[model samples]
Target: MEKRIVTVQYNYDVAIVGSGVAGLFGACHMDPSLKVLVIAKREPDLTNTSLAQGGIAAVLDTVNDNQEDHIRDTMIAGGYENNPDAVRLLVSRGPADVRELMELGAVFDRNPDGSLNYTLEGGHCRPRIVHHKDSTGSEVQRALLAYVRTLPNVTIWEDSLVALLKKDTCFHLDVIQEHTDLIRHVNARVCLLATGGIGRVYEYTTNSKIATGDGIAFAYRLGARIKNLHYIQFHPTGFANKKDRETFLISESVRGEGGYLLNAEKKRFMQNYDPRQELAPRDVVSHFEMVETKRQNSNDLWLDISYKPADFIRQRFP
Candidate 1:
C-alpha cells in the first residue's frame, strides 16, 4: 500500500473535522464523486470512538425486540427530558445505520446459531447492544477506517488540527499541521464538525485526549446552535492511576456479563438503590457509586468480574 503524504493545502466538496466514527461515517455517506477531506488532531484511529468499549445501542432484532421499548428506555434514562422527535429519529434510523456498518465488513458478535448476538446494557430492557465482544467501538472504527481508506475521493489528514473555522459564503478552515509546523487554509462547500465528546474538560474521563470539546467550541465560536452543554456522562469504572489523567475505561459490558460493584465491605449495594440494580443507566449507576463511595469513605470501588470464567473474560476483553 502506498502511504499518502500529509499536505498543507486542499479544497474539497466536504470538509470533515475530527476523523472519529462520525466524521468517517459522514465521509462514507457522501457521493463517491464528491471530494471529501477528513482532519484529525492525531492519527485518525486515536479518536474517542476508538476508546469506546460499549456497543452502539439499536433495536436490530425486531422479532424479539421493538423500537417503542427502545424509545421508552431512552426517554426514561434521559430523565424524561429527551426530545421525542430526536429520540424517535434515532431509534428508527439506528437499525439502518447498523446495517450499513455490517455491510462494510464490521463483524458483530453472533450467537451459536449464527444470528447477531445482543447484550443488555444499563437502562435498556432488551438485549439491543450489537457488539464485537467487549470492543465494539474498536471494531466499528476499524471497519469504517477500512471502508474510508478505499474511497478515492476521501482524503485523510492525520495530526492536523483545525484552529478555526472562517465562514463568509462558505466555511474556510485554518488547520495547523503538526509535522511541518505549517498552517493552511482549506475551503469547502460543506463542513461537518464530527468531533466527539467534551469529557476531556473534566479531570477524569474515559474519552481520548483529542475529545477536548473542540467541535463544540468551534461551533459556538461560529455562532451555531448548541444544546446539552451542561449534560455529561460519567462511567463508573475508569482505570485510575496516581497521575490523575487519561483514565482507561473498564467497559460496561463487564457489568452486563455479571460483574458486580462492591465497596470496601464487599457488599453489593446497587440493589438498595434501584430495582434494576447493576444494570441501571450510566448516570444512575455513577451517582450511586459516588454516594456509596462517600458513605464508605473510600475513593475506589471494585468491579468484580472474577465470578465469570477467566477464559470468557480473556476471549471477550483481550
Candidate 2:
C-alpha cells in the first residue's frame, strides 16, 4: 500500500476561481503581503469579460451626469424592484474602479479636445458610458491581466479546473491540471468564486464558452443563499450568424453612438415603440423585438447606421 499525504506546498492566503473581470479586479484589491492564486479553467482570455462589448456605465462626467441619475436609471430598468443599497454602492464606487483601470493602461476614446468622450446608452439620462471603441471589455481585460501579472504576490495558473471545493477551518480546492490530468489539493484562508454568467443554458445567447454559471452553483451547494437567479437578462442585438450556435454580440454602444434598428419593411421603427428609439435599454429593446417580430410575422430585422457620417462611425465603432 502506498501512503499519501497532502503537502502544505499548495497553501495560499487567497484562492480565486475564474479569471473574469470580477475575479481579476477583486485580486487587484488584496494586500501585496498576501499570497494569492488565480485559477482559470482555460486560457486567461477565455472569459465572459472579454465578450462584453457595451462598455462600463459609470458617472464619469459629473457635470452632465450625477450618481442619483444613474441610480434612478438602473432602478427603472429593474422596474424599481432592485436593492437600493446595492445599486447605490455600485453607482458610487464604479467610476473610481473604472478610473483605476485607466491608470493601469486601459484606454477609451477621447474627443478632439482630448476630454473623455462619453456616449448615451438606452435608459441613461445622459452620456455616461466610457469605452475603448467596440472592444471595451477586451481592453480592460488586457490591462488588468497585465497589471496582475506584475504583482509579485499573485500567481496565475491557466488551464486549471477547480473540480470541487470543501470547507474546513480554511477552504480546500480540488484543482485538476489539464493535459497532465494531475490533481492537486490547494488550501486557502479565503476563497473567491468569480465564475461568470450561465448563458450556455440557452441555445441562442451572446455568452462566451466560459459562462456556465459554475460559481453560482458552487456557492449554492455550500449553503449560500442565492437571490435573483430568475432575473436573467438578454442582449438585444447579437449578430445573426446561423453557422455559429453562440451568437456574436453587436454592442449596444453602436446604438448609443446613433445606430438605427429597422424592421423587415426597411423603415426605422424603434421611435414608434419607445420615444428613446435606438437609445432604449437592453431589456426594453429585446422584449419588444420579440413581441413585434411575432406581430409582423417575420424573423428578419435590419439595423442601419449609414445615415451617420462614415468617418465618424468608423472612428467611433472601430
Candidate 3:
C-alpha cells in the first residue's frame, strides 16, 4: 500500500473515477454547467467495455419480444437472485437506451429493411441483442467518448489512477499519475467510481487487465454496503491458453449462432447437461464444462463453427 500524501488539490462538481462506458456515458448525461473530471488508470479505451464482444441485451423488437419475457429470462438466468425491480427496469428502459446509443453515433448491425439486427445469446428466449458485429462494447465506448469529449464541462484525465478516496463534507480523492510519484488531491461534490470487475484476481479470465475490483475495494473501505460479491459469472468459452492471465473470450454469439462445443474426442457433450445445451446460461454451461472436464479426465474442449460458410461467418462477425 502507498501512503496518501496530497501535494495539490483541485475541485470539481463531479468526479468519475474510471473511463469505461459507465463513466463516459454518465459524463455525457451530466448537466453541461457542472465541471466534471473523469480519471482513467490507463488509456481511456483500455477497459472491460473495450473488451466486451457480446452485444447489449434489450427488448428492442416488441412484436417478437416483451419486457415480461425479458425479465423472466433474466431472472431464470440469474437463478432468481437478481433484483426484480432492477431487472424490470432494465427490460423496460433498455431499448430506449440502445436507441440513444444509436443517436450518439454508435452503430449496430442493421437488417436490409434498416431496422436494428437483433441476435440471440445465451439465456435469452428471443433474439434481442443489438450489436456492432462482435465488438459492440468498443463501438459504444467510442461513441460515448466522442460525445463526452465534445462536452465543455467534462475533462478526461487519462493515465491517472485514484489512489485514495475519503468523504468529508464532500468526496476527496488522491489521484496519482501512472509511473509517477506525485499525488494530487481532488475534491468533488459527487464521486462516481465506475472501475470494473475482479477478473484479474482469477488465474485466467476474459476480463480486461484493469478489472481488478478497485471501485469495489474503495466502496468497501468507505463502508458501502456491497451485495452479490459472491455471485460471479464464469464465462464458458475462453481460448484454452494457460500461459496468459488474460484469456480471449470466445463470444457467446458463437454458440448462439449454431457453433458446437466438443470434448477431447470431438464429440458434443452439452446434450448430456441441459436441453438448451450451448444456449444455456453462462453459469450453467461453465458448471457443466468443469463437470465434463472431471469426467473425461482432461480439460480439452473445443468450440467448432467450421461447418458454417466462411463468407457468412466473416460477414456475421466482421
Candidate 4:
C-alpha cells in the first residue's frame, strides 16, 4: 500500500491537544486520509498515561466477568453518583478498546497457557485488569506512540502549549511553542482535548508533574461545561519519602495481589473500616487511611505485601 501524504497545509481536518491516550486514540480512530495535528505541552511520552501504574479495566473474559458487574462496581465506588450513560458507554466499549491496544502491540501479561492474565483491583468483582507488570502505562503509551508515528496522516507537535481556543467555523488555537518562543494561530475542522488530570493543585499526589489542570482550566476559560472538578482520586500507596516524595507510586495491584495495610501498631486496620478492607475502592481505602492517620496522630503508614511468597512479588512487581 502506498503511504498517505501529510502536508503542513494552512489547516488540518482535525487538531488534537495533548497527545496522551485520548489524543492518540482519537487519531487512531480517524480516517487515515484525514490530516491530524496532535499538539502536546511536552513530549507525548511525558503525559499522565505514561505515569499510570495500574492497567486498563475491561471484561475481556466474559466467562468470568460481565459489564453489568463492572458498571455496578463503578457506581458503588462513585457513591452511586456517577453518570450512568457515561459509565455504560465505558463498560460497553472497554473490552474492544483494550483489544485495539493489544492489536497495536501492547503486550499485556499472559498466563502460562497463553490466555490473558486478569488481576483483581479494588472495587472489582473479578480479575479484569489488563497490565504489563508494574509499567503498564509506559507499555501502552509506547505502543500507541509507535503506531501513531507510522500513520502518515498524523503530525505530532511536542512542547507546544495551547494558550487559547476560539469557536468559529472551525476551532482556533493560539499555541506557543516552548523551545523557539514562537506563537502561532492555527485552525482545524475539529478539536479534541485529551489532556489528563489535575494533581498539581494538591500538596501530595501520585500524578505526574504535567498533570497541572491545564486542560480543564483551558476548557473552563473557553466556556465549556466541566464536571467532577472536586473529586480527586488519590492512590492508597505512594512511595512516601522526602527525596522521591510525589514521584513514585506503589501500584494498587500490590494490595490487590495480597498486600495488607498496616498501621503504626502493626494491625490489619482496613478491615475495621470496610468489609472489603484492602480491596475496597481507592477513595474508601484512602479516606480510611486518612482517618486512621488522624486518630493515631501519625503521618506515616505501611502497606505490607510481605506475607506473599518472595518470588511471586519479584516476578509480578519487580
Predicted structure with the largest TM-score when compared to the true one: 3
In angstroms, the error of model 3 at 92 is 1.1
lDDT scores for all predictions? 0.89, 0.87, 0.90, 0.87
Off by over 4 Å in 3: 1-6
Question: Which portions of model 2 miss their true places by more than 4 Å?
Answer: 1-9
Q: Is candidate 1 or candidate 2 better by lDDT?
A: 1
Sorting all predicted structures by lDDT, with the top scorer first, yields 3, 1, 2, 4
Write one digit per residue (lDDT tens) for candidate 3, span 192-278.
989988988988899998899999999999999999889888789989888988998878998988899999889999999999999
TM-score of each: 0.95, 0.95, 0.97, 0.94
Q: 101-202, model 2: which lDDT tens digit per residue?
A: 999899988888999888878889888988888889999899999999999999999998888898879999988787763677898999999998899788
- Steric clashes per prediction: 0, 1, 0, 0
- For 1-318, candidate 4 gives per-residue lDDT tens digits of 864433222488899888888889898999998999999888889888888877889988988888999999999989988999999999999999999999998999999999998888999878899999988998999999999999999999998888778877888888877766467778899888888888866788888777888778778877899987789899889887766536588899998898999988888899888999899999999999999999888887898999788999888997
Candidate 1 Cα lDDT to native: 0.89
Ranking by TM-score: 3, 1, 2, 4
Q: How much RMSD separates candidate 4 from the native structure?
A: 5.5
